[model samples]
Target: MKDLIKESISDLKKSDGFVYVTAEGEKIDLHEAAAKGIAVTPVNPKSEVIKKLEAAGLDLTDSKFLNDLNELISLLSGSGSTKGKSGKRRTFSDSEKSKIVEEWKKVEAAGKKTKAAFAREIGVGYQTFINWLRD
Candidate 1:
C-alpha cells in the first residue's frame, strides 16, 4: 500500500496535482508548486478523517479532483477573503483597453454581434474574446 501511495503521488505530481501522505511522521500539509498542486493525505490518519474531509465537502472523485481542489484553494488564497488579506482587484490600463475595443470594432465591422459569437467565428472562447476586447 505504501508503493500504491507513492505511485499515486507520482501520478499527481506529474499531473500537477497533489496526494495524501503520512510517510513523514503524522504531519499532513497542502503543498503547492508551479508543477502541480499536492495534498499529502496522512497514512492511516483514521477512517473518521476521510469522513471529515467528505463532511467538509470535497469532490473526492478520480481524474483531476485533487488538482482542481488545490487550484481552487490557490485561487481563493489570492482573492483575499480566503485569509482576510485583501488585495487590489485587477484592472486593465486605458491603452490596453482601447486596443481591445479597437480590435472588437474591427471584428464588428466584419459583422460580429456579440463577443461569444465573434470568438466562435474566430476560434476562441467568448471569455477570451471579451478579454481581448478589454485588453
Candidate 2:
C-alpha cells in the first residue's frame, strides 16, 4: 500500500494524467496531497487507498501544500474549486489595483454631480460608479 502511494505520487509528479486504479489500491488522500503541494481530485477521495493513507502520518489540518495539491487535482481531473479552472483565485496585480483606484477617483469626481448624469458623461454604467465606490 505504501509503495502504491509512493508510485501514485511519483506518477502524478511526472504526468498530467490521472492515476486510476481499483478501489483497494493505494491512494493518496486529497488532504494529504494538498499538504504536500499535490492536488487531490474528487476521484482521489473515493479510492480506498487514499482513506488508508489518511489513516497514516498525513495531517489534513496542515495548510502548506493545499494550494499545490488542489492545483494538481484540477490539472488531472479538469474540474476546480469556485476560484476557477486553476483551483485558486487569481488576484489583481499591484499595477491593476493602482489603475482601478485611479479610475475610481475620476469616476468619483464625476459622480459628485449625479450618478446617472456622471455615468452618462463618462459613458459608463451607473453600476460602475457603485462598484468603484465599493472598491
Candidate 3:
C-alpha cells in the first residue's frame, strides 16, 4: 500500500493540469495567480454577498463602505475561514510539503483510515492537501 501510494503521489505530481483553480472573479493578483493556474469563472453576480449588496443598495463606489461591507460579510460567514487570520488562503513551502508527506506516510502506516479522517484529525482540509500534492 505504501509503495502504491508513493507511486500514486509521484504520478499525481507529474500529471497535473490544474487543481486549485476555481475562484470567483477578482483581478487584483491575477498575474501571480496565473502562474498557479487559471480558472474559468464569472464574478458570480448571484452570490449572497452580491445579493445583499444589491438589496441594501450600498454605494460600492465608496471605498469606506466596501471595507465596512467586507467586515460585515466576514462576521456573517461563520468560522470556517480557518485558512489564515486575515481570511487569506494559506500557501505551503517546499520544506513544509516534505514534512506533511512524511506525516501522511506515518499516519498511513499506523492504521487504515479514510483520508478525510486523517485530514480532520490533522486540521488540514483534505482537498487542500490533495491540491498541494498535485502541485
Q: Which candidate comes out best when scored by lDDT?
A: 3
C-alpha root-mean-square deviation, each candidate:
16.0, 16.2, 18.7
For each candidate, what TM-score against the reference?
0.26, 0.21, 0.32
Model 2 residue pairs with clashes:
27-49, 34-65, 34-66, 38-69, 39-69
Q: How many backbone clashes does candidate 3 have?
A: 0
Error of 1 at 49 (Å): 16
TM for candidate 2 is 0.21
Question: Candidate 1 lDDT, tens digit per residue, 72-105?
Answer: 7766665212333234444556786576678779
Q: Which ranges in model 1 have alpha carbons more than 4 Å from their true place?
A: 1-88, 116-135
Report the backbone clash tally of model 2.
Answer: 5
> Whole-model lDDT, candidate 3?
0.57
Error of 1 at 75 (Å): 18
Ranked by lDDT, the better of candidates 1 and 2 is: 2
Per-residue C-alpha lDDT of model 3 across residues 1-135, encoded as one tens digit per residue: 455445445534543333232455343233466676765442332233334444556555688888776767755774233333563555778998778877877878887766777665545789987765576
Cα displacement (Å) at residue 88, model 2:
19
- Candidate 1 at residue 4, lDDT? 46
